[model samples]
Target chain A: MTTPRNALVPGGAADQGPASTTPSGDSRRLIYGHPSLLAERPTHYCPGCGHGIIHRLIAELLDELHLGPTTIGVASVGCSVFAYDYLGIDFVESPHGRAPAVATGVRRTRPDAFVFTYQGDGDLAAIGTAEIIHAAARGERISVVFVNNGIYGMTGGQMAPTTLLGQHTTSSPEGRDSSLAGYPIPITEMLALLPGVSYAARGSIADPSQIGKTKVMLRRAFEDQLGGGRTSIVEILSTCPVGWGMTPQESMDHVANEVVGVYPLGVLVDRRAAAAKGA
Target chain B: MTAVAERPRLMKGNEAMADAAIEAGCDAYFGYPITPQAELLERMARRMPELGRVFVQAESEVGAINMALGAAATGAKVLVSTSSPGMSLMAEAMSYMAGSELPIVLINVMRGGPGLGSIGPSQSDYFQATKGHGHGDYRVPVLAPSSISEAVALVADSFELAARYRTPVILLADGIQGQAMEPVMPTFRMPDWDTASWELTGADGREPRVVKSLHLRPEDLEVHNAHLQAKFATITEREVRWAGEQLEDAEVVVVAYGTAARVARTAIERARADGLHVGLFRPITLWPFPSKALAELAPRLRAIVVVELSAGQMVEDVRLAVERVPVFFHGRTGGMVPTPSEVVDRLRVAWALTAPTP
Candidate 1:
């Protein structure tokens, strides 16, 4: 449970190594440890889990947007249920699948405050489907970060609503039969169809380049909410190595190949661009 | 009392509660339409947006309650209204709110139940309201208003009590009380309480606050339950409220609440006119039960008669309070409410059975 090496420290990179005197002999130099917006504690997520990366991206965006002091995050039930413990911002924990509705409340009540919901695949597509759809349909001015790992990570690789047709989960050890388990739902595509959704995009963190792309999508989603856009959401294809019974590298390779093939990555909808083009 | 301009207006019980909530400075209202309580949501839809407050006709009762819970976490005053079935759907979130110790007001305009029984008036929810509606060793302060005026007052008071105790408060009215019209002064007064210390309003350079009910450790959960129990005990001690009419020298006391209390009052009046020693004891706070007051008044009366719309749900509480005094129950279930004449006849029979030999 050691802290991530990339955790941001107060000073810059120079503070971590031996102090280098810049002729004038100024002592203190900035270095890295953890982001200012992220808490200085080790997360309980397993090795190779994408949650840490997602958390870092969110914290980075929050810091970049200068929204740390004015942001309220709603945490959904799942592995990331303790996202509040990792983010140094105000948060409210909602019951399974209710984070979107909760975020709606916060967004409507405090329009000036940046509100967002951090949700997982099962939490967003199953029990909470109605909440997310209604929130989008209402054009609620809140940002949502949906992490799709294709399985219930915290609950030990159980079948999730977004689990692939032939995916093997604890509940579907026989390799999910379509007649029994049904097909994987494309929640991002469905949400993008709602007129109330100003932006809906899908990205992945399977590799360095994908992670960078996902971060851009995340920043854009947050910016959309800040710009008074309604119901912006970013669906990130995440990896759950422990749940998938694979090494962290193997999970990353799987996400890059199989997962990306199944769930294509890119901007599914961009209402602002569409509106400008129409005008 | 602080002086304010009084504007009397005739309004239904549901609308009165909505008006009172808005007048009390409720910042948001999230609700799903349900019979007997739809007017409350309608009123909110009409008024909340005009006042620049938040109003959402949620997709479901479950969504509405959770929305209110979310708003409450942000230190915003919130209200959610529903009927029996809707309340049942919201029970999960209500329990979560109580466990989290989030202050929010929930108005349950009860109707016949046990399962979508009917849309008519019924107090079957008395047990559900006074006892914990959701799982856990927590109790939300339940207020029963017998009249439209009391409904308005109690709806306003619900917010104050909820904020003071940091707990959910239920304004348990009935279909009749919700649908019936009565004149009331549309007075508004914001609660004199501050939530800045705990409410999750952006942390703002301070320590981040989390509004949640997740205690992983057994020992920690036990401690949390103990702390909640202490708060509930204080509320039980300080917030038990009721009304006693003509109980000084009464031979029999009629106990009731909500719409049934009004019927009992009429019954008491008719019995008194007939030269009978009958009085009415109406509980304003169903949860705290006003049991102590009833216990104090028990020894003076020969017997106690409990009148309710349900099949004697609250009679058990009455009996629990007045153990020595013989308690009798007269109830009409499945949407049938007993009239004054029927109640008076029942009271006469009860008086004969328990009154001293003469």
Candidate 2:
């Protein structure tokens, strides 16, 4: 399988022309190629689902970082449960909401291995709130990739813990009333308050520019954990077109216009910088 | 690898088990503190870090069990100990471990519970342990040790059994056994497991190994369940363990396990001295239930009396094992332990009922 045309490159994919090969016929300098760590098989993710985009980013980083041979991934329940199938890495499928705890088990036992947990809103924010919080508080040497799509796409568009206050879904048909459902939790910000978290960031993939920024955030998270930092996390606000009852373009727009407002982007915490300065 | 002690040391059963686990080369331990078995976690906390092994006092039983599952997935020998209420909290992860076929050792220092009943010794979790504590079709080999020394030996065996079968194994004890102080010989088996085929170290030189139980298709799940059932069947055939005293010529045998068996041993000895033919049959492997062994001796015994700390939980398994043999049950529940004299009284009645009418 060939890499997508819009795949990330050093100077951004938009700057390169259709000529994928390098001028001197050097393979390493080719503009775009398939990620080495990603499997060639087609994924089961829905069309225009942000999970594919996020998976590609992670695979690309794993390839660049040479972590494919030493990375152990803990895949949480939900659409991303099949992450092992697409990531081509050793994976332990954890129980719903327990990926962080599972990752801790792996990281604690195999300190040389790079451990990460990929989780969704329902898996991370709702049922797994305690696991995620404690993992961050304990400063577990693991990276967490939290994908907040505002709805349970795999379970047929149920209201998620990260769903916007006025968002309507199967479970919240009359629109989520703040009085009954309470406000959406800013889990990343709350986790950032913990001293153990070395890097906590929020990013979006609603557009190309945002995707690039989000990839940078993901790279920072991976690098922080690899550098022996405790609990690096990147929360990515993503799109779910089928679950949200909208076209792919409309869903991306909704993520950009609505989701970004509730969950703002950028690095909220970077303790590594402070630690470096203190040293 | 070998039992050797210049002088036997009196240690708490939980502590002895922890020492045995360490001697068995446990690579990691994750547990939450609970009554009765809190000493086990404390012992690990003190010893594991000293040995440069992994030890984590998890947030809760749920966290502890999942962490153990994760460690086990990495092919590390892992241990987790908790009491009944905590065991209840760990049920979900136990199910996940069973489905994933991860070989982690769990010690359930059972306490009285219908829901926070009491933190005192009770064997009420027989049904829970033997009949699948968690949902789904799976089995976790349950080892019941009656004394501190036996618990020590079984703790080592638990790891071997777990690795041999590629499944979780439970060392089921009661609060009495967990808290009792007895002289124990320092002994444990060394773990020699070859986990290269499935352990999740890295995919550098081999295909990536995935430890998961999620089979989306019903047919696929059924096949997986069938494979698990087959493994369980082999475990039953190869791993049935029980100990019997004076069973050769005894007319009546007392069937018991764990703490209840300890009391039954004294009762059987006293009854034998009183010229009544009585024997004690202790099923060490609770999940397999040692049914074949019990059934084999059923025809020779006139009657079987099942004693338990619970209100007759393991008695059901006894009844199933000895189909036609008259089985009597005596139980004490809600943390109330039956005395040796109490068990003797039940044995006397069963023996009298089965006596020949001359």
Candidate 3:
């Protein structure tokens, strides 16, 4: 796709142009903000942070699925607690690690509404381990968007549950030692073992093509829930440039290189598709 | 006048409260199984699905309370019940629910406990319930019901009070009340308020709604605290309720609440039959404490006797309310309940001590 000439214009001016005949005798179309984004102001994320890309993809999916009117999102603690502010949908902020439990309530009460939770690695893999495990075990028809940056970005680059072995974080200055810190938890794989979970996938946002793949995984997760499948989870390997003490380009390189080796990408489980194939 | 129900049926206090929650059109119930209160959860599990409402036996008390908080944020009439130790586990989420100002109803079927003391009845959580059970400068309107019928009525009223103030309300009962069966006329009605105006449905064509309790800035937190305080003041003024019996000509009055109040009532009657001028003042709303009414009656009474199932937890409040009048406490704890005769004996001693020298 060719980039628009006025792409850098603020407030998405390039996408606000009217349909007109191009010099090549083709009709031109403009694309503005995603229907579900409240892009009235800039985000609070650091420069080169992966949250912006992830948030945009979620907004686009909400628009594509037309779930804005009936979707209830649960925002977990950490960097994404303010997701409700940027996403043009109703939300309830859960305490650290409680988003799964909260989403369980919302989904159970409003079965007709699409419910999802946006959580970071620390929020889901640490304090909230029980909540997510039980919610999945109960087969709650909710989608979970897990962003694994391998560090506690909001709390200033501390080690997270998904921190890679030998990774240098503020809390693990000498790099994480398996003997002391144990190994990084592969939560998606663990959840996939549960019969209640209908779909589980891990993707990366390190490159444009990878980001596109991540969006596809998220869309499939949401579709599974919409089709009355049990719990669906899409764990996207993200980046935290400031927290990782690296440039944006270097951080993406790290996710593509280091994180991908420790936490492999691809669909861990897809019960519906597997069943169809079996039949 | 509201129309009366066709016929009263016999029900346990726990089941009566659960039935009342359904009649009041509760949208969801999330709770764990705990002794004395397990029947409430059992009833909800069976009935909520039948009525097309939601019910979940949460993995833990913490999960249950948080789930209720989440449902409440969506403007659903939510309820969660637990016993002493279970209530302790739910305190953190309860504080968050209060801070968020989301309306919810919590039923605590009192059991003996400093730490799982006993499954038997005790009022040890009086201080915890009335004096900011969780952590904060906030208060929950607590209604203590003495009988099964009153439990049903209070449970029904709790939903309305919660919605009216957008705050948590507690329907406090004891193990005795939870286990004992009595005749109750369950009345069903929808709440007389609009929940959609504040509840989170969806953004749709309007601004999105965010329900949260985190006030990071000091200034913003101060404002939130002030707003909560104002709401509490209004509730205290408008919602104080109690049953004052035979106080018109009594010289000695017994102040009690919940199951203890039933014993106090019998004690007062026994004293009255013996030609003793004793009355009973039973508080229904514990947080408001019926301070004004107690103070007004303090000047005329010679002594105020506080009867309780704990070691005099509520006597402190009685002392604060009736400064000049002498206050005496007679109680039991550790799953033990004081007999009516014991309360009458304490009343006599209090009366004798306060008698004027002639």
Instruction: Give every collision pair in model 3.
Output: none
Tens digits of per-residue lDDT for model 2 on A41-124? 689998879999999999999989999899999999999999988887899999999999999999998999999999999999
Question: Which residue runs of candidate 3 sit more than 4 Å off their true CA positions?
Answer: A1-26, A29-36, B1-3, B187-189
Best by lDDT: 2
Rank candidates, DockQ, best first.
2, 1, 3
> Chain B alone: TM-score in each candidate?
0.97, 0.98, 0.98
For model 2 the local lDDT of residue B19 reads 95
> lDDT by residue for model 1 over A1-279, one digit each (tens)?
223234333344445565545644366444433567776677899999999999999988887799988999999999999998888889999989999889988888887899999999999999899999999999999999999999998888999988887888899898888898888899999999999999999999899899999999998898888887999999999999988889999999999989888789999898887888999
Q: List where candidate 1 sits over 4 angstroms from the true fold.
A: A1-33, A277-279, B1-8, B185-188
> Which candidate wins on DockQ?
2
Error of model 1, residue B94, in angstroms: 0.9
lDDT for A167 (candidate 3):
90
Model 1 reproduces what portion of true contacts?
A: 0.79
Candidate 2 per-residue lDDT over residues B186-263, each given as its tens digit: 776786676768999978877788999899999999999999999999999999999998888989999988888888
DockQ of each: 0.79, 0.85, 0.67
Cα lDDT tens digits, model 3, B168-266, are 999889999999998877664556545787787776766677888888789999999999999999999999999999999999999999889999999
